[model samples]
Target: MPSSVEPARPAGHHTPGPPGPAPATPPSGDGSRVIPFGRRTTRTGRGRRTPQPPQPERVVAPDSPQQRLALDVEAWFLAHQATLTDEAAAHVYRTTLDFLQLMLTSSHAEERLSPDEYQHLTGMMQVLRDAPDTL
Candidate 1:
């Protein structure tokens, strides 16, 4: 309402609110909570966090290079997903992507994975990235 950039809303209709992030714009890249510019963190009349707590740092062991890489790539992809061309997007499956996203973003995504095991997941992502017809 106080914003000079956003046009005034209709008298009766509610002002447009952020339902979620826009395409290519993720809420946060480091797993920290981030509200978009000019968007309310909560809905009007809805229960919102009072005195938000400090987000724990997303730190992983220095030894797990593969795990670290996985997180970095997942975060990057999430932040850039909206920019992917339709042809590139078509090659990926939502379900598979979601699964990889979750697995990579998990606190200890590489807990049980060996170097070889990590390669398997990355290989799967690569295969899925541009899955071409075998026929």
Candidate 2:
């Protein structure tokens, strides 16, 4: 007895065409297809790209001997102030007051002191009275 089986269709027949490579696609107006390697593309709306504003340059002053000396004196005074005990600080305070009063009296006698200087001297005297004497 002969078998009654139909012949199987070939794979190429089902797909059609000689499979001779895919057809080339035309480029889209949006430029989405071609990308440069290692570079990214940004989508900017129809406006023109504006250049960024320049940054302001910083100005620095050169250090001078007088300024350095002033800083050194300030630092030394701060260190000395830090090391003082309450009793010693009180004594220093009294001494400073006496010295300032002497200077103010001399300035008054010489008529060389400005009103502002006299007022500042008085303010310093008041501050010394209120300040804690020792560290």
Candidate 3:
């Protein structure tokens, strides 16, 4: 049998020939580089699932007080509903803004009020509404 090893070539001509398969990667334009080995693998079966584009995030309207307030109320209602029954949360959400003027005047209306304070006032209203039956 022939020897397993081939005699070594002289320097500068020692590069081995191709191992008999076409390269998996497309050739680069310059041909000056071959992609490093093991960077890709061939799949034998069905192709990979292409990733889906992400759904766009829900964006709050900028610089609009009404939109911001509506979104805040919606978010608050969702959170409140998690702790309380749906009917109670709905009642609070509907009636909370009904007393906005009263809350503003009571909370020192000379200065600006925050959305959170308004939400707090609504929560107080919810408590007050339930207090009568509890007594």
Candidate 4:
């Protein structure tokens, strides 16, 4: 078998690479950006399920106060991910936001969120809402 390691390159050598995707936000002093990787992986299945007409639909008006609040909460967490308790909480918050999206678009929000998880989500949102600068 060949060696497992690659031969070292000269110090002055530079390899061209594709420009990476734009950062969601400006990098901080550490040159790191926060990414919301939870938006997609939170939901998994054979495929998306359509709502059954027989089930009652929960309507959340796009401009309604609750919807507005949810939007604000999401934006805040996305911008302030570094301040969150941990990466898992940030992921869970994204999952919670996705659940809210399901509530608005389908009759199936309860399937992904448990009572305790929702309670924690709401508690975090409530803290943000209670902040002096929250809208």
Global lDDT of each candidate? 0.53, 0.56, 0.53, 0.54
TM-score of each: 0.24, 0.34, 0.24, 0.23
Regions of candidate 1 where Cα sits further than 4 Å from its true position: 1-95, 98-110, 132-135
Residue 66 miss distance in model 2 (angstroms): 28
* Clash count (model 2, backbone only): 1
Selected candidate, larger lDDT, 2 vs 3: 2
Residue 32 error, candidate 1, Å: 91
Best candidate per TM-score, number? 2
TM accuracy, model 2: 0.34
Per-residue lDDT of model 1, residues 1-135, tens digit only: 356687765655544435665547544575434343775545585566678789886554564554555455455556976322344544464456667846754623647666666667667665444322110
- Stretches off by above 4 angstroms in model 4 are 1-57, 82-135
Clash pairs for candidate 4: none
lDDT by residue for model 3 (17-130), tens: 366776688567755343344635477557778789998864545645444444555566467554223566556544654566476656755556666876766565554444
C-alpha lDDT (0 to 100) for residue 130 of candidate 4: 35
Write candidate 2's Cα lDDT for 13-89 as tens digits.
44233346644775467533433366455855568777889886433234544344434444555787642235575
Clashes of each: 0, 1, 0, 0
Off by over 4 Å in 3: 1-42, 45-47, 71-135
- Per-residue alpha-carbon lDDT of candidate 4 for residues 33-88, written as tens digits (9 for 90 to 100): 32334445656766889787796556666686666665666667669754233556
lDDT of 4: 0.54
Q: Model 4 residue 14 lDDT? A: 47
